[model samples]
Target: MTDEGDLIAGRYRLQTRVGQGGMGIVWRATDEQLGRVVAVKQMLLHPGSDEAVTEQAVQRATREARVAARLKHPHAITVYDVVRHGGKPCLVMEFLSSRSLAAVLAEQGWLPASNVALIARQISGALAAAHEHGIVHRDVKPGNILISRDNTAKIVDFGISRATGEATVTDAGAIVGTPAFLAPEVARGGDANFASDVFSLGATLFAALEGHSPFGEVDAAIVLLARVARGQIAPPKTTGPVTDVVLAMLRNDPAARPSMRQVHEACTAIVEGRTPELPALGRPTLVLPARRPRKRVVVAGSAGVCLLATGVVIGMSLAADPTTIPEVVSPPTSATAATTVASHGCTASYRVTDAWPGGYQAEVTVAGERGRRLVGWSVTWRLPEGHTIDDLWNGVLTRTGRHVKVSGADWNAVVPAAESVAFGFVGGVADGQPVEPKLTCRTP
Candidate 1:
């Protein structure tokens, strides 16, 4: 029902339909109040669709605004605000004078290695910023990269992106993202992470340089996905010196891929005609499942992006060990309450889990706020006087006098966005009253 000249929220006036995707339609609009041009993306809902579908669409639009707002980079699109019109949410974004890189490639066939390196450099820098904030841009295809006439590239369409530890918004058991650019692990039904983004970006650049999918083109989506799942990449003939970096990204193993930061540095090196310094490939952290047919599936248009609908539940269990800290049972009411405190956009809660004649076990849970991620964390507190620390798990423990410090372990170092990681310890308590020590958390 939206058309040109239609006013939204008495501020933005729609002027033209610019683009349409599986999730929404984008428009070129004028901000009458601010007297500037802006892009407005309205959620797409089929006519006569049920209420639940419409609600999901609205949530997706709102989430796009929130997730994109957390990232600030020159080569990334900026989200201005989320406005509602006709009972649906619309995302107001910075307007760019450009066309999609996909469109550019379709017209020009392919670009030179130097030009592709420049574009990749810009996109990698923006993606590096997103990763630093604990955000994974699941879809990094050419359709998501906009190229201006002047060759300035901006990465857009974070509608399907997710933060570390954040809950999945879609239904259960759904795998989203364009099949052509999906990393082998994702195509093999593994979860997408920071490394997945690296693979997708590499696939994007490979497509731009090769003028076709690195996995080869196919008529059916399933067929292309099957090829992607096999993890065999066609070598690049157009890209000369850039070939090594591109192939490094297309490695079958996710962990074997260099990080976006390293990719950016390598791209910068390629542009400068210097020898790129990349790290040795590491072992893949993900194990692909055995091949099998999937029941539920969804595929988008030619330039379709993917979505997911799965949740990960984190839990811990400990056995009774007299020498080590055991699980919390029944503690005194006064010591049962958890003390919650916030630090560096993360929340830490301390609670006592078990108490014996002269010893007690306690745990501290550190959770990152929505859209925030913690690479590593350290919690510090002053233990009761005359108390000696005995044991700890899920983190490294150190004591200096009455002060105790616990840092995350290799297995549980990163606290995903909207996710929590915990560490527990047992210590000898003072003879008198059971006093809880205040917890302070720091993240980097």
Candidate 2:
């Protein structure tokens, strides 16, 4: 066992143990040479394992680490380096102070619809980026999505990911990834592809919105695998706006599912409070009719087509809801008007404009005190745990762990105390209702 304070590669000094999984233990470490914080994940090999099997595991780990290193995106965790310590492969990664989506869901049974959408958008974006490089994330689940304190959703744990056209690592009939989130084909021992990744993502989002897996809450591994193979998904009750997208993604036939790009686009549209143009469902893969009666055989259009139509209706309904309309209060022209003071002479308010499972869209208004004309301004706040900001407008937003800082843009920096400057953002709330962050403002 590697003890605390062990130095690997003669540079990474382990500080403390951060997380542990079946594969390995992760440690918070510092690169003495680079003088920066990093995460070091050491691969775990079972005792008494065969030498050849151990070698294969090491190779697989090395390959996956190399593959993950190639992915460079804001929503994806950055891989810094890979090293070998004590005959085991260790991955050096960018350190992030964050909680997994699984932890968030455990704390809060279900996420708000808008928060779900924001989460899905960021995850889909990461998947799309990975897919563009021919990398398929076989294990796309809540446990792998890290929600930083600043409300940034980053896709992590690419340990099981493989590049397309690569030789299979697992045995021919063995399935990988979490059973609950597996695609039907993958659950049945089919090779994972880009489509399967999409299915898993759909399942992840479904769980986030509905508080359980689409396959329901079966505990037995075999029973869950059977249910996943059967692929009968229950519609999410709480996915208010993005229900159609979720249903379409959960299609039993991988071919019938939308691409990650389409999912990202739909999610982006939902986050921006616009009607998403549903992608055309792909043709279902042909299957031979079974001789014996199966528990459930999913029909293609029954779920996908119907859900697409339902989403259209929901879009229309939302468009017609007067209460959903945004009310952006512009700043006053005069500097002498009375204005409410927030923390440090700045008043701020947050409003949820639209929401769907896994994500939400919100507008934050920050106003200076009356008669105080400001040349430049910065707004800082602490996001609720498990919440992350995906996109924003009218401000430059940066997050460090759970603390978020938003600085006024060139166009909006000069604010008279009589008027307020407001900025909006789309974020994912994992644990509870999106709360107004404790706000502080600085003006110079």
lDDT: which candidate is best? 1
In model 1, state the lDDT of residue 245: 83
RMSD of each candidate relative to the true structure? 20.6, 19.5
lDDT of each: 0.70, 0.67
TM-score of each: 0.64, 0.63
Tens-digit per-residue lDDT, 1-444, candidate 2: 698999999999999877654356778899999999988888766555587977877787778678888899999888888788987878888888877776566546567789989998898999999999999988787777778878788888776677887764653444566667878777655678999989889888877777677776553344455556666565445535577788788887777788999999999999999988766773222232322221121110101000000000001011112123322232222311323336655666665655556665566666666546566778887888778876554465666777888876433556644556566566787865555555677776
Please report how far candidate 2 places residue 387 from its true position, in Å. 44
For candidate 1, lDDT tens digit of each residue in 253-279?
A: 676789999999999998888988788
Cα deviation of 178, candidate 2, in Å: 0.7
State the TM-score for model 1.
Answer: 0.64
Clash count per candidate: 5, 22
